[model samples]
Target: MSDVLRQWQALTASLPVKALGLAAWLLAMALVFGLLERRFPIRPQRFLRQRLAQDVGYYFLGGLVPPFLTVAATAALVWFASGLVPASFYAWVASLPFAVRVGAMVLLGDVAFYWAHRWSHENEWLWRMHAVHHSPTELDWLVNTRAHPLDLVFARAVSAVPIVVLGIRQGNDGLDAAVAVYLALTTLWAFFVHTNVRWHLGWLEQVVVTPAFHHWHHANLPGTLSRNYASLFPWIDRVFGTYHLPARQFPTTYGADRELPQTLGAQLASPFRKPPS
Candidate 1:
């Protein structure tokens, strides 16, 4: 108990540093993406549009997202996959060169994330939680932060748990560093793909996911929902038969069909409540 208390205190001690770092990163993202959107927006929108404040709230909330996701994913992994795989396998994977492990993790994580993301759309209960993210009528880089923490945990755990289970183990700084790189890559890419910029990458869209590909995933229009679930790679969606990108086109509308709570507190609590009749 004393050990646990020490760890908790240590974590709390680090919050200010983490929060400062996050604030700096957020400021940079706003400058870069904000300029891009203002110059080449897919859809015209104000710099300070409606719900901007709420999304800014989400920005800070998003900083806490990864740790919770990691904890939930690790706990789930130990609960489910414990004793299923040999210890030697994890050690062998961890023994690989740092670059190799990071490369493998990016591929493995995206594949896992693709299926998990698709399942969130297919599963009714998951959709209720995910709907909070989809409730935004406007899309931008900030929109990436607007997610239900529970939904974020569940969908990400499917990908994250496997990475934790199959590769990264505790106490190995090298493996831990690799996972951190993977997380940074995926998280930055998410912000890019959700940005409102109109600059399409042409053939690169086929290679990696672009705003065009992911915006379609967020499209609330008829026949556009549930396509393009892969977060990093576009091929995963193609392999899974969920890819749906059109040439020189973009989604006309964005958001979920159902009405969702607009405020942060209400959005967080929404998943546990029944939908209005």
Candidate 2:
């Protein structure tokens, strides 16, 4: 146990060391999920020609960089836009109890995300950016992070960042705690929904977004395209008339109808390329 303690001590000694620890944790989680997929894969061919490198690149970029940039850019924008929103408006939010404030923050974030996600589908130019996420042919936990930078930024701005920035501006003491809890909750949920676990939560599917539910959103097959946009709550999709969770069914196909570029660089640039006639 002395060696283990020494390794732990070394890992915590510096910021880079801590990051290496995180990278190790991430790899372990990937291995765990990969094992789970092998045992309980939703599709039989889930492992066939695994796009390991392409997805790992996106997993890091989308999971780490985009979210950090979202918070940073939001903080900057809120600083500039603070003059527009009266201090009294957010002063009230700052005064709420911890539980209530986090609850409100989550709702505000989810609502913003819901609308922005819908807009990504409805707007063509936005779809170009959003398509990178839907280009996956296989469904698994790692696919959750395969989003475009624009897609991640836009969604965060619409949902979580606004509430967070407001909390920061309003002098909320628990903003850090709230943001951490919220990100934790969201990251867990995102991975859960993208999982290869063959689950169908009989009644709860009506309330929450499940892997089966989101698989439909990624489904490019007949009667399964461009629907189920809610990130956490399925009821929001019901309200918006985009919800379509067929009983005891998963999408047969997983990808956009058209082919997206295979390389990470090319996929990033594909959004900017003009659609071929």
Candidate 3:
């Protein structure tokens, strides 16, 4: 209990630094993707499009809040998981080279994220939470931050928990570094894929996710909702039979057909609220 409280205190103390780091990332992404969208837009629009303020609200709320919740959620999961896995496995994992561990984490985390994202679409209750992310009619880098805290926590935990569970339980800095690398890769890629920039990197698209690939996932058209579920790697979707990309084409429309609450507070409360009778 003392350890948990100490950790919580440390985490709270670090919020300012974390929030500033996220702000830097958000600003850099906005500048880079903002310029790309302006130069070669899939759908030409202003920097401050409709609902920009709401998405910005989600940026801080979704970005700042989830780490706190995910730590608790993943800590519980890691406790149970560590007990199930043998000590030898973690020792072996800890023994591996730093680059190897990072590569392994990236592959493992991406696969977990693929299924978690797909489940969010297939499951009704999860969709209610995830719908907040898809509520935007416009697609841009800022929109990537527009996710419900529950949605953010769920997706993050599914990927992060397993990695932590399989990681060096004795607090090896290598495992810690590897997990950081995996997160950096996924976080930057998520924003890139959500950007409004019209990019289709020929053969390279097969290796990594691109805006065109993920834009189809956000497509409002029927039958396309279930496609492009992978975040970092397209091969996961290919293996799972969810990959869908067409040459010289992008989603004509964005966002879900179903109505979601428009405001941040309402959207946060929406998942728990019953629908109109």
Candidate 4:
């Protein structure tokens, strides 16, 4: 227990600056989104009103919990694994060429996340855990954290498997660097993609994931609700043939057709129970 605490403190100490920077950036983006929503309000074609305070509160609490849990769980796992496995394994894996490790981490991580995300949609049991995310009637930057704890935990656990396996099999610093960079970028991109800003990068949506493209995923429109599951790159969607970019403007509606819980307890307990019928 003491060793675990020490390791946790060390990890947090090493990462504090980066975490603080990310928090600052997210706060700034939230402010910008709030300002934009006020300036160029999009009339809701749906019933829900913007609950800015609730949304901000949800983001603050939800965002902090998952990352802390993820990091702690990951650190514990890695620490234990290091004890069981030969140090040479991690060393060798980390020694692999930088480009190869980076490529492997990005591709493997995204593919893992992609399948996990798609399965959440396909499986009724898993969908319960994921439904809290879709319950939000509003689409804004903070709304991205509106996920059940189980859903977040499962996703992170699954995603880390590939990284862990790679580290043990080939142990390389490049892979570590790649994973770090990917997490940082993806975290920022998630906030940006969920923002209410209307900036579109023209043809770039064809390649990279953008706020406009992601907002469409949250759209309550029947067509878009079933499309755009890719987290970072659109190539996975295109390859799987699930990509659907409507020629029409963004959907005004958000959230599922069914009603969802508004209370914190209900949202936390949602994954275990069936969604409202």
Residue-level lDDT of model 2, residues 133-181, one tens digit each, is 8888888888887888878888877775667556632554766776787
**Candidate 1 CA-lDDT value:** 0.81
lDDT of 4: 0.71
Weakest 10 consecutive residues, lDDT, candidate 2?
3-12
Q: What is the lDDT of candidate 3?
A: 0.83
Which regions in candidate 3 have their CA more than 4 angstroms from the true location? Answer: 168-173
lDDT of 4 by residue, 57-146 (tens): 566555555665676677766776767768777777667777877777777777787778888777887878787788877776678877
Check candidate 2 and list the clashing pairs: none
Whole-model Cα lDDT of every candidate shown, in order: 0.81, 0.76, 0.83, 0.71
Candidate 1, residues 1-277, lDDT tens digits: the string is 3544565566668888989998999999999999999999998899889998888888887675556445645665775665787878877876777767667778888899888788878888788888888888788999999887777777777877666777555346576776677678778989999999887798899899999998998998876678898888899988978889989788889998789986789988987888987
| Best-to-worst lDDT order | 3, 1, 2, 4
The better candidate by TM-score, 1 or 3, is 3
- Please give the range of 10 consecutive residues that has the lowest summed lDDT in model 1: 64-73
By lDDT, the better pick of 1 and 3 is 3
The candidate scoring highest on lDDT is: 3
The candidate that wins on TM-score is 3
lDDT of 3 by residue, 40-115 (tens): 8887798778998888788888777777788787778878877898988888887877777777778887899898
CA displacement after TM-score superposition, residue 40 of candidate 3 (Å): 0.9
Model 3 Cα shift for residue 91 (angstroms): 1.7
